[model samples]
Target chain A: MNQIDGKSARALLLILSTFTYLLFGAMVFDKLESEEDTRVRDEIERITDRLKNKYNFSERDMHLFEAIAIKSIPQQAGYQWQFAGAFYFATVVITTVGYGHSAPSTSAGKLFCMVFALFGIPMGLVMFQSIGERVNTFIAYSLHKFRDSLHQQGFTCLQEVTPTHLLMVSLSIGFMVIVSGTYMFHTIEKWSIFDAYYFCMITFSTIGFGDLVPLQQADALQAKPLYVFATIMFILVGLAVFSACVNLLVLGFMASNADEVTAANREPPSAIVLERFARNSLVESQLFNIQKHSTVGVLPGRPRRMYSIVPNSAGDVHLRRRSTRRSIQDTVCCGCFKPRPPRYRFSLTRRPTNISHLVDLELY
Target chain B: MNQIDGKSARALLLILSTFTYLLFGAMVFDKLESEEDTRVRDEIERITDRLKNKYNFSERDMHLFEAIAIKSIPQQAGYQWQFAGAFYFATVVITTVGYGHSAPSTSAGKLFCMVFALFGIPMGLVMFQSIGERVNTFIAYSLHKFRDSLHQQGFTCLQEVTPTHLLMVSLSIGFMVIVSGTYMFHTIEKWSIFDAYYFCMITFSTIGFGDLVPLQQADALQAKPLYVFATIMFILVGLAVFSACVNLLVLGFMASNADEVTAANREPPSAIVLERFARNSLVESQLFNIQKHSTVGVLPGRPRRMYSIVPNSAGDVHLRRRSTRRSIQDTVCCGCFKPRPPRYRFSLTRRPTNISHLVDLELY
Candidate 1:
């Protein structure tokens, strides 16, 4: 496609996709609202009728059921905003900080939560995978350059220069920073060390459990903007440090196998190759033994071939020769093996040559 | 290490790690409690003292703040649990069907919510990665066996069997199951379709948002066991289907090149060969051209080897060549690129014979 056409098509596709999502979302919302309103009205009417027929219920009991029913309304909404928020929430939950103040308690709510997470978690994964791909590529490039620099300095492996030692050093610095920051926040906010660290952990994780918010009233009144700015800066810096550590760890592993694979498209060979090799070795040994035992009974029509030479075996030479003849005609080598050339006179003569002689012959 | 000794060491290491985590967690909890208690007492004292001095506040407004503050205290106490639940809640929230009647609203609570999520997401990722690794290995093994069976029936590549097609088929079945299950739950619980779907989403996601709980008065009076059994079955089935989809999707992606690099490691070819090939390719490329009148020349044996390559427009070519060369060297050739030997070679001959009496000679 032409560039202009391609650009327009892409733009159109983006708009269309977004619109489709929004349209479906709206439909779901409408359905939810209509259905929920009907259910609520019916429920209220039934409760009212019961109250009229039976002895008057206490205000507390009435309030309890109302609270329960009131809690039920959100689940019926099925709005897109709620789903997006929930999707973000699940990523937080599995990590186990357990900021429990917010949760679905109703059966329907819990059930919906489980269902939404099942799909959303995987979708979140796909997003993370895409991000990881980019991050890995950047790291791989940096490591490659680092390796080249190390090689120029006469180092064989990056690890030999103690990359892990450097990593530990960096981590120590990071740990100190986190501790100091926590300590400062503790003093300023009048929080205990545990609370400060907890705040740090929660803030860093982005789970925001919110069980212990820093409510520095005096500081807030005096410098609200400054307080907010510091918090943001602390979070950003913390995230950067954390990301760096992760990158280093990843790079360390990659550096060990740096020469073999790129950050992208590295695949290990199948285990089947090793399995087949072992199986074939066993089968070949058995065949050799059988041939050795049966060789003396062979008829005169079939002449023994001189090609087969089974190494590390107890088989007779005559049997080996006969088996070689049969194998030459019947067997097909598989996986990393090719059939030997037909018994050519030239090859037979060349086979016994030493390594130096072969090199000399090739060069000449 | 001896096998038994190695196993014991591993067990010890695992226990140590767990202990360390618990100790760190307890320390954080202790700090949180002390800090929170101090802040609450101070706040309550300041508020009451203000009320004693200022115009009298109504009982309801006074009660509201007290309730809010009291409610906020439980949030801090259940900090870890709430954090976990919130994380679960987030999963449900983002997936839609919010079941929002339950949420973390306190400043401390919201702060924890944000902080917990950031770290928890990555932890969740690590968990998923471990699970994915096992699942991928199992699926690969199964696929290999399946292919072998098909090979006996003479099929290759499951030709025309696209991964996308398989994904669609799996998703179709999954969607149907979800829809039917939701519909059935709606009928049984006398809930609206939206609520049922919401429940399904929450349950699948494992969010347990807890807004619209299932309440069966008849079941409570009768077969409570049966009701519990049905709930368990629902969950198990949902999990099975979810896991099946995940496994299938992962396997399908794995059948292609994208899955290769992410697989476990194997040794690759030596680096020297790749470097040499890359150097050769760079010199031979068309972009290596340099004019005699230009500041830099492209002739061999230049002192500015590094400088010449610095502004090199052939950067992409260099990278591609390096990566490709590395991959090729690492992989076994398997005769994929074996050069064809010359079919014929002429021998120079001096002859006194007539043109009619020609001689032919072969040279190896």
Candidate 2:
């Protein structure tokens, strides 16, 4: 899709999805406002009040309880504001932004959310996936020169690196950035070390739980602009760094077999490997000899060769082949080497030259 | 990790994560209880009250406003219950339950949430991945004998089969089970189709948003036994079906190339396929050439060979591979035997040879 069309489609989807959520939210509000809901609420309040009076709740306790009760009620607001918040929340939740401020309470609400998430999460994933792919392409393109420079410097196996290593590298850079940024944020916002670290963690993760938001409170009035600017820059830079890390990690994971290739090139199989093959062959041959004279009736013949042992100086190791014919065993192991002890043996009418006969050998 | 250890670790993580959230909740609640917090609350309330009075909100409007306001409040109980609810919310949000009954209002809350999700989501993913691996190993072991029985009857490409198809097969069986079970739930719960579907979706997704929780609101006489039975069955069958689907999906995504051993098994490359390969090769060559040249410039002289191709067919197609020691150019022909002009030339150097370049190539 063209950028405009793609964006419009996204907008439309967002609108429709938000509308659906609001419709549900409205329904829920209506339901809770009903006589039955009111009765339940009243009963719960009464029970809680009795408990409070009996126990003598502190002023702090009363305030906390009252705050929760107040927050539980849905607000009447303009569709624009409510929808904006809801859509934003939806985006945050699916994107893993989570901003734990708002969440479902009723079992039915939670249930619906789970249902919404099944499709919504995947859709969100596709969005991130698309962005990630493009970002990766760009990074690969830009890093091409840098990598080439490194190549000239005799850096081999650059492409064969592990995700963990790449993650560590990126994380080191990210850690430095976070620490420096957190320190700066602390100076600007004057939050404790734990709070600053916590804020950083929450922001980068996109949890946005809202409990510890920056630049929202009234205290840091003088540094508001600086704090806001820093917050934005931190998020932008942090995201870019994070995205780069993700790209590297993904590429590293996808290139997991690179090490195998390097190993293969470094060391070719030795003649000793061949000798081990031959020893395995001798074992199979002796088992086959015993199977030929077995008393049990022969099983139906397979159409394809089940196993092949190429004679080498080391010994013979069985190589199982894919079966093309119907009724042929997909497994190609010799009967003699079967892990299980055989109680009966199949007596073939003819001694088959093909590897299929390997299956007829029985274990005592 | 041992099963017991694994279980306990998971439990501990869950508890710790929940506790951390609870601590945050209490802190926020404490803040909101302070004189300053109360002032902010009053300001917001005044603004909302003005909006409500000026708009002359209807009863429905009043309900919506009340709901939103209730959700906007920070805390409603002691640390224990607040922790319990927050823990449940965290689980629901991560699991995608999203009941929507409670959500964030403040910017700080929303922002903090985003940060929380970044780490939590990935952690959850790792946990799920490990669990999935174990479950797959177990399933594979158990199915080994049954699969052998089928193989004895002669089945091919079973290993190469896609997981999507397997999922389809599983879903067919799962559908029947769900249909019968949902019907029973409907009979027992007397919910409408929308509510029933909603319930099923929520339960299956494990969001359990709780807005429409089952059995909790049922008549006291029937609630005890029925609720217990439903809960047990839901947990048991829900996990089974979920694991099965995950197993099948993983199987489907695994590479089938490793299983195909035939020398003549090479499939003809589709046009799109060839184009992608060519693009990837060009990029790789460019990168390699750039790196080599840069290295050679620094080293003064280095023996390198460039694998290059020139277009044989009519058109502007040219293929070139250049290295410090040698360069090769060959004629390139497009699938339709048409030639195209070169768009741009850029080189990458120091690229990892073992890296599977094709993964970066987009087939779509």
Candidate 3:
């Protein structure tokens, strides 16, 4: 109960923090852009008034003209509901980048889009995370192999690959992707380099304000198939790489947070036993009595298997079963419910040379 | 290595699946909306030509008129970089809705926006997840306490809260928020009920297509402060509720997937021991000799304390430590690195009454 309260308090605090951050961002933006916004508004208004005076257009006709002009901007891209444009739109929707360059105008189209995104977004999220994890793992494996080759060459440098090494690799890859994308967009779209870079940042982050969407001018979506393909690939691949960085960063952050939480919330042990097993130390013998209990899913009165790990300090780890009969009891309260009290026991000891093997115990 | 290969293969498969899904969605959207898109394009072109003929305007003048008209749409919302509108934009950016209603026009604003988003998006993500988790925990605790009260009143009808119950509650809350938002937008913005509902869905999904954005209709950002506040609250609160539903669903999905992966990848046990303690059965003499090994974090040559949990049959659990001196050997390889082989041991044993407490073991 106390744990729940603590978590709730933390969540409330985070909510407050986010709102405060938003307010701060808003103030900064207003300070930076309000004058520019006013200037643009006045310039556009002056142009509109000049055009109205030159054309001598009626109020209703001028309104209709503005409506037609505003509506025509997206149509200038040429056949947005055609296969190529539709595919681009699909990618945008699933990614939640949602450039809003071309949206479904028909009611049926809108309904289908919602239904499609309902499934597609989650699928995209899972797919991106999976690919991201694979990328990280590949980087780690490559680093390990590189270190091994260095060791073989008698250079006692570039040791084991840590999470930090993987993070650095992913960050560099992400940077390279952004730089290449910025260059490509600048060359092909005739956008200034800084604008191209900003677009890359916005698109990759999935904010995608769409103020300067690609493939909209000169009917590029239909005319320049290669540019279109490159743009789509860049968006997809860049997102995957960014997801890799995010995965590593979030995992590290969460692990440290978990340690802090445990330290703060854990009850002190009644008895302390000091045990030490230094790294590179050859152990003589260590036996781990493994105990697993089925709490949720197992048929009542069914026989369950148990095994202990006997790591022979000098040889391979062995699994041994202790043949002991224990009498079974079934109380079977409402739906066989059992209320368990919260009990936490903290222990620190050393058994083997393999930390990875110990972490893999999570598979159970 | 085999596990990594399997994971890579799975990621590759997911990527392929998502691409195929995108292709399928594209084909369907093309079939549904292509004809309507053509009709709208033709209508807009006809109106533009008619106006051009009526006014007999030069090509350059007509082009300038269209540009001015297009630029004026955002200005219609009234001073977009003002405090209220800027706050709305900030909200949109961090939540990743990115409505594209009014993006930063100045280079400084754009640079600031990117930097702000670099930190704000992650913070928002963490905040939402934390709130979602807290909401679930609160619901579970409330349900548990309610069940306890029922039992005390001699009802004993309701059981413990499950993940399914929490999901349902969250889904209902999400549904209510959407319905209420739809009604409010329909009444205030004067949009069709279906369009209002669609707007709510798009906004809450963080898609923010901007086709039917709420506040841009009648200068609502500046003129209707109460409405603006309501819309912002709806977005933030709705996202939080949906996150709670997503949290429950994703966790349940992942838990089942983890179980499947473990079952498929785990090697067959070399030996087996049978033990059974049914639900509501009082555990007797369950001594968990927790041989905790300090794998990563502890000063070299420092003594780490170890403890064992001895759960008494007739009383609360007890902690006991057996004192024994064991000689330590420090191999001290490169950086004192210790390579651990992959070792998995499976065991089933009787445990004390708290399953939550056992699951909380992950905190370590």
Candidate 4:
């Protein structure tokens, strides 16, 4: 298939998959919640009718009272636009975990929110991703050091730290955050443990259904600064942990995708060419002892330069590039010639082994 | 600085910046919304007091009425977990919109929701990213073809399609979507134009404050199939468009970061080494006419090989790695050697100019 068509086809496939998933979700939700939804609707009707009969309020007055009551819930939390609540609201906006327990009612406030999100969301995304990548790297480094320590203590059974190890660690941390959050909210808000756990899941996943918002009862947003602070911290830390998990998942997904494509014959020419180039480069550098696996030929010319690819003690492949007039001591090692540590790191390209990208000449 | 320390410092800087931003947002929100919030709160108090006086209801009954009124709001929208509403809810969950118009009330429903979100959110993310990337690529391709056509007609004024052009086009498309959505909601839902616009912004950002959710009134989710379809499409397409814009922004940010790091002397050894390797490889292939800018040295050795890097007619640098055992026809162009077109394409490494990553031997 043509490269562009293939790209389009893959996108189409994903869209179809998502649509099917949505359909499945809708079917399941309808099954699970429909009976309950009907029951709640019937219950609400019964209560409203009973209230109307007891109060003997006019229908118009009842409608007005309902609107007033609905509007007053946020006010019950006390001064929602005040500093603490506003800060909480700001966190929700940037994180996109808006619970809607309180929203700006004025048009100007709404407009400011839109503008704020325009810049804040991107900033938030980049920041969270950066933090997440660093966290993953830290975990990997820690695991690497741990394995080294174990080996030093005569435990040679441990393998090198892999993406899976980092993933598991990050996920474990995420689980702990959820559990702790559940405990905190359950204790303070007097919600059932199961309900608190559900709240934690909803909040952390950023679904934030707002069905059971924290800091809304007993004027908690205003009266309990420490709890509010903890809630905010929970949100930020939870998101960062989740982001780390996502980064690993994305990298794993890419690797598997590459593997699948490699096993298939119907691959794009560009990819085939690149893969061949990568293989040839590896062979040329003599990065591995694979001479028996594939044949390598030397190009013949009068002023021919023979580049030796050798493995260092660390098992890293190093390519020695030497010009004809230069001495062997002056030979440059191509492998270690990185321009700078990446400023904007994406986890996918951070691993040293997964390098296949050509250097950006513009940057060089 | 040490690499690990540098990483930690950057993350710290980002956290601080975000904290400062939240502070600024809180101050501004306090200034803007406080007066209106106070006013609304007082008005609700006055109205509720008057109603209580007229109805002669007890405080307990008033509290009951308030709770009942809030519960009845969702009920008023009809059976929320019916097929159409359930589908809407599914979209909201995967997208992380969480409008909170209706949410799972039962424990089983809540448990299922969490599990569903765990798998669904990632799938939704991957699907949206795939579609967004393909859309951006298609736009770039279209612009490239348009420029080519114009040049063929003697319109040399048109330059090649650049990232800036792509960003502008994507932003414009996003603006158009928001405007159309605002117009649609304003007309159909009887929301003011500004409120509709605010709703669009909030929904697309996935903040979803839920204060002004569409399809909640008039039982539109169940009654108006076409409207429901349009609203769902608006959310999905709007998100995809924003994702495209974000992709470009991230790439631009990375390029700028690279440029900044290159201009500074305090760069990491790994990047410096890699950059040098990339430059040396380019020079070895003689891919550019940069001999005037730097010295070209020949190494003193037997069995010497000299590699020539030449620029192809398209101005793309092609490194011809020819083996002496074969004729020139067997020469390979290293520039075009991309291992199968990337399956999990991150816009960052998709462009040809930004290639610098080493090939993954495991994949090879």
Candidate 5:
């Protein structure tokens, strides 16, 4: 369709434009700031030279002071505009996840940052939206397939897999990532497990707290480019996973409160529809769509009385009822297969009309 | 109503849970990390005392090394778990905009960060959404009122203000914020105008490149709690502003490329719906909603000779057309308002029936 094509084109334009802006920023920063940096470094050298002369400093003392001087000065030196730092700068700029470890120092660089970010931030959001959605949907599709396979292999026969199950799985996966990152960082930094975990959590969350950064080891610093690249992958994938978990959470919240009634007849649980609602919450809108959803419980075929309030236009909320009061048995995965009796005694006395009303009911 | 109440209730529940978690984390971190911090400080003090006696070091040299020792230490001097830090930690946790200036150093603290973020980020998103949407709608309402007043004053007889005009106004407003922020920061930091602007861009964008942070003055550092609190306000309101601008950009992109047919006559340009595209893109689904569109550029009453490919349920793309093109005029604002003749000269060849084919055009 022209719509999709047009959008894809516009998106491409935005990306290309962003790259051009980034390169421009990088070049301007390198050209303008590298000299200022050298001048500052020269000034430090002069001061230390004067101190060495004035204090009758021995070679060892001079060496010590020189090291201190080097440490105190901004470490960027002359390489700020080079590929590694520029690439890192580019990532920081676009993501708006400023590590604060490195930045554009010159006036031009600052101006460029303002101008560049004016375009870059939205472009970044679009990128994240595009990538995050794909990654989320792909993960969901995979999970669905895994569930389907489980059913096929006689693992279990459930009508619909709930968000609770998905959330647990995703959370488990996230926890695993944190644990593994902790191990890796602890090994590399030779820090306590606690410190490593803290670094990973902070980094993965896009907080870039910069308090505990990596590759301060002199040898490791030699490969700053590689380090930056690896971290970018880590952050991107970590965010994608976190987003998927959040997506499942959003879905869980939306679907948690379906008060279903059991009866002698019912239709099968339909697949969840991923509809588009425009906001920054791409995942939340994609969460639990209630178009034709009736009994969102474990046993879909069991006839149940369900009251769902769907918000319709013109200031009216449409309350649909699929009512049946029959006790149903659901065999859930706990350890062994056992049929659990569904509770039909509890039901909501209040029927809500609109979204606000449904929200009022704590239906989630 | 109940649903809204329920969501609000759930949201509150999430906040309460997060607070409890934060308290637990703060207490645990205080108990565990304080001992470690004290041990390090004791060692540093012992070494300095011994050094003072071991060698007849100059007082100035002793002072210099002391400064170095303090700087090299991790700066969390028994203050990590205090209320001020804990509250700051909470903001970092929820926003995921980790400044990394201060972080939890204990295993319990690390675990808490992971757990807290799992719930807090969503809550933050919801809060941001609520605030941002309210702010957006309010601005739109105010803008509408301004336009209404303008119409009443006989500025123009236009029935509706175009998205382009509104976009320019918002953009100008956003730029003004940047310029004003730059000025404020420059005076406070005693930095060049460019550096100030850069810092603002980096900070507000959430990249937070720590190279140029705020409130480093001696007095400000003494009042660290107030500084943190103020900075929190700065970040929150800045992010809200950024979100609003992005929302408008999303609207502009979605509404810009309308394939409208010109009639013998036309109505004025109506405002874009911007109602509920509940994701980062607030306008995608809105652009194509043609039911109420009156001034769609090309023609009013007469239809356009345009081919559209709509996707069907069975993996097939359907090509449909409602054709009959006539000339139209559009009044757009640059510096001044001018009516431009609609171009009927440019037309597409090789009308695509599928997404892939349309993508092949590379319209960008």
Candidate 6:
């Protein structure tokens, strides 16, 4: 496949997989967990019966009493693959947050979880990475363009002030997300802003301490699905902005060292042509798209040089120039490029820059 | 820093960080939670007094009576970061488990968590990866040596059978951890083995449900510190073996294709000198102390060309033969090899095998 086409499809695959995954997970979890769910409900009702007799509460009032008391039940708690619960489960699984508030109780559910995680975790990562790049490229391009626009308007300090400016903007934006979410959670959960802030921080980091879960209010059970939906939006946006901040951090680090890299190698851009050999859609940006809709081009022959941008350590852009001879060997005979002894090769390419990457690069 | 030395130091750092982090976390949590602990005790006493007045339960039976009634009190739940609780909190924070069964309720605690995570998460990952590599390399070398011993005994099929054999052995070893853990948990918690199995799976995956935590007996809280210590050991070993499996999978996949790779590249082994240029101790492996003890040598002139081993997108090991001219440039002029346009570069390295890496490399 043309790498660009392949890259573009990968992002779509993330969405497609999520929908199909959710559909199947919901069905399977409901199936596997229903028996256990029924037992839990039965036990709760039986206890309610005993409590009503002991406390002299009415049958209708007994349910309210059980709903309140059921929280004390050590085992067989609720949220067993009910739609809200299942959706919540799926979110945590894909995000790899795995709060364990609820889990697959049956063998079948366990098998399904193993199978689901095998694919879903990678799928989620790809989606996060792709969207993160788009977000980063958007920010980088915007900041660059903003700087250019300012320069055009005779504001000349952008060259010196740009990194700090970008960081400030990114930090403020990330904090805004925290503040806004804190307010919403504060109002809804009647938690103090401190509690809300703590929750947001825990969540966006994907630590997902189940202690501060939503749908806790007695009144919210009827609107459980809506709550899940809101929670989803809350998490996704938080993740995106959080990822953007991380990207900005990387760029900031790189820009800080940009002077050193540029100063060290003013030797007319080496004839060496480093290509980003990654599966990520960042290579799709080889044919730059300003947005998903608007396609643009780097001047035909002088396409901009890209190094590995995303940090997950999977689709690192290979900086080694594919020599023409190697390119031919790559096409006519495929294995030459695939089996180069990487152990020795990394040692051979021991420049200071590569060494820096060794530290900065996440092995994932 | 030499890559081998760096990698070697990393494992030690993990242990060191855990101790320092635990010491600080324990101190902080104990300080923060002591106030709340007293409040909870007071509330429990007051509630016991109310129940004692209403139901004529004896003062000697206060704890048993409240153990039943204590379930009703919503505020001031258990798991306060006393020495035991604090230790658990530190484990979750470093591991990114964040079970939230017991989070810091105080503002100081919350702030500390964020700061702690900012450093600890990355620290933990580095340690996991380093330890995982050491574990993998040890296993691989041992298995290889084992196979050689079998061959010395005149076994012919050893080469063909080794990879699969190693996998089976590794798998059995991993399963053994689970079974032993299940047994211990079942006996301790008086849960069925099936429930124990569920807890182990949940805990190892870092999902940490908090639903079936250990040492729940009224007699056990007095030994809560001991229980916490046991839980830490269980989690650490589980994480270590689990990580080792993941690393092995990467090697296993690459080794699976070893035949195809060797068959495809039959040209005289190019004079490719592969030096492991890690900031890790893997290059220290070049000075092999088989299992962190004895030292060895890299044959001075004839270096083995290594290939890309781990498929994680970041820091992919590239197998390239360093040509004489490039070697000079690499040594004399450090920057010449570093500057390459990344955009057109990925497109330039198109080959069928490379495309497969795009898919197969990310099985993680």
Pick by lDDT: which candidate is best? 4
lDDT of 2 by residue, A80-108 (tens): 11322333334443444444444443344
For A1-364, candidate 1 gives per-residue lDDT tens digits of 5322443354355435433433343343333333433453455456455542453535654344334333322222222113222322333333222233334434444454454345444543333333333333333334445655887899866532123433454466557768977987898788877668766765444434344434224434224546544654465456445544554553333322222212121112211111111222232544433332222111111113312334333222212233434443332221111221211112222223322232223323
DockQ of 2: 0.04
TM-score of chain A of each: 0.31, 0.36, 0.71, 0.72, 0.49, 0.49
lDDT of 1 at A186: 90
User: What is the Cα-based lDDT of residue B295 in candidate 3?
Assistant: 15
Off by over 4 Å in 3: A252-364, B149-157, B252-364
Per residue, candidate 4 scores C-alpha lDDT tens digits across B140-235 of 656656776887899977554445566688899999999999999999989999999999999988899899888888878878999999999999
DockQ by candidate, in order: 0.04, 0.04, 0.28, 0.30, 0.09, 0.07
In the range A249-349, model 5's lDDT, one tens digit per residue, is: 44323222111111112222211212221111222221122222122222211122211222221011111111211211121121011211111111112
Tell me the alpha-carbon RMSD of every candidate.
Answer: 22.4, 23.9, 13.8, 13.4, 21.7, 20.2
lDDT of 6 by residue, B1-364 (tens): 6322443355345434433433343343334433444454455446445544654544544333233332322212332333344555566666666665555544665677777667656555545544554555455556556655887899866553233454566577778988988998898778888778877766666656565666545435335556656766777667767766654554333222221212222211211101111112223333211110100110111111111211221121112222322332332222111232231123212233433333323322
Model 4 misplacement above 4 A: A251-364, B251-364
lDDT tens digits, residues A1-364, model 3?
4444566688889989998999999999999999988888889978888888998999999999989988888898777888889999999999999989999989999999999999999999889878786777567656656776887899876644445566788899999999999999898889999999999998988988999888887888899899889989999999999988876776444333322322222111100000001100212212211111111111122122221221231121111111111101121111112321111121112322322232335443
Error at B182, model 2, angstroms: 9.0
Enumerate the chain B TM-scores of all models. 0.32, 0.36, 0.70, 0.72, 0.49, 0.50
Model 4 agreement with the true structure over A146-213: per-residue lDDT tens digits: 77788789997764444446568889999999999999999999999999999988888888889998
Candidate 2 residue lDDT tens string, B107-157: 443443444455445444333333333333333333434444666789743
In model 1, what is chain B's TM-score?
0.32
Question: What lDDT does model 6 reach?
Answer: 0.45
Per-residue accuracy of model 5 over B21-117 as CA lDDT, tens digit each: 3334334333433344345445545644554465556788655543443332222122333444455446655666665555554444556566766
Which residues of candidate 2, in runs, are more than 4 Å off?
A: A1-83, A96-118, A133-144, A147-165, A172-364, B1-127, B130-165, B169-364
Quote the true-contact fraction of every model: 0.03, 0.03, 0.60, 0.62, 0.18, 0.11
lDDT of candidate 6 at residue B329, scale 0 to 100: 31
- Chain B TM-score of candidate 2 stands at 0.36
